[model samples]
Target: MNKTVWIVLALVAVLVIGAFSGYNSLVNMDEAINGKWSQVENQLQRRADLIPNLNATVSGYAQHEQAAIKAVADARAKLAGSQGVAAKAEANNELGGALSRLLVIAENYPNLKADQNFRQLADELAGTENRIAVARKDYNDAVQIYNSKIRTFPSNIYAGMLGFGAKEYFKAAEGAQQVPQVKF
Candidate 1:
């Protein structure tokens, strides 16, 4: 081959290799982000599933606390209706808020707090919340990695061309500000 033709071919090969490397990294990062999001969803689902049993345990003790019961119901309904990740996170936050409210109500009933069933469910719910928090933090961290990659130099170019998008953070509601205080 002529010298000029050889140089041009080598340049083309270099560009193709760089682009493929960048694209593959972005794709892997995107998949990792999605997998982290799925983990968060499963943890949240665990919390949601536990709520009903929690409500029933508390209900048997605090029958007259209609407002607390209603809060839990409303939160669950909101969670059920949520569509996207952002919406689901918002709804989950609301549910956490409602759960916190119910726990506060439970505080007024010493008998309920002392009940073995209530205590057991409370422990389970607390563990579930911890798991959810860990999952959410991991998800947000994954999103950050993907977003950074999609915004930086060559990776950014590949990300944009391949339609890689930024993701939202998973945040807790205002009421999820603190852990529920459980007294035995």
Candidate 2:
């Protein structure tokens, strides 16, 4: 066989192996990221479920805190209703802010704060928030892995050919951790 023919055959073999490995790795990584995203959604949903109970408990003592309750509800709805990762993350950050304000409102009602039901609900919500933080971290980790695989050299070539794109991180919006200046 000619030298040119041997060289071409060797190049083709390497490409075939590289393409297969890259494509498979991308698929697995994408699936892991998607799974992590689902966990994040579930954690957020759990927090949303806790809102109505928390609001009702607080409302019994602070009836006039209407606008604040509505704000929490609205933010939860937005978080649930959003369609994409960026939209959901933005909404989640807003919801966190709104709920923080509601907690601050709770501080004004000493009797309510001392109630067992209210205390339990608050504890559950706090636990949910912790879970959300952990879940978001996991989701972001998966996103980093997937995005890296989808962008790196040989994998990037395979990713483009296979229609894989960079997965988004569920990032906190501005002031996500700040105490909201509650007008209520």
Candidate 3:
């Protein structure tokens, strides 16, 4: 009887240790997701900040293109006020479309394309877009890992109990798959 009790105690201790390890790992993964998302937001904010300067430079030569300029500003405002991944993604797509139109307008003005300030701002915007892409990829990757963990084996049991639900991915908006046409 005593031997049986000792064996039972050992099993209980092992189970306890395993539970702690699993919980800690989940916490670490959840934190990693948060960090990656913050990076995505940072990149997004950087792009937003660059927009005003870009718009100003474009405006100097394309003063008549008020519709395109207003669209970009409106999209930027929508992005700023947006909450959640889905909403932000939608707003981002709107902003991207508006910016593309704005650029197309710029193309009509040869002097605008040749302007040094416009060139610099455009380059910076392109770089920031790249950074935003990388950051979104990283965030989605982390979410994928975290979601996998919460859906798998023993961890799944406690994950729900601990309130660690699956995280949402930063998905691109619809129509993103289509190639944009640029006609001269």
Q: Which candidate is the best by lDDT?
A: 3
Q: Who is ahead in TM-score, 1 or 2?
A: 2
Candidate 1 vs. true structure, TM-score? 0.90
Q: Which candidate is the best by TM-score?
A: 3
Per-residue alpha-carbon lDDT of candidate 3 for residues 1-184, written as tens digits (9 for 90 to 100): 6999999999999989998999999999999998998898898889999999988988888888988999999999999999988888889989988998998899899999999999999999899999999999999999999999999999999899989999999988787788979899
Off by over 4 Å in 3: 179-184
What is the lDDT of every predicted structure here?
A: 0.86, 0.91, 0.92
RMSD in Å for all candidates:
3.2, 2.9, 1.6
Model 2 lDDT per residue over 16-53, tens place: 99888888888888888889999999999999999999
TM-score of each: 0.90, 0.91, 0.95
Candidate 3 least-lDDT 10 residues: 171-180
How accurate locally is residue 162 in candidate 1, as Cα lDDT from 0 to 100? 82
Backbone clash pairs for candidate 3 read none
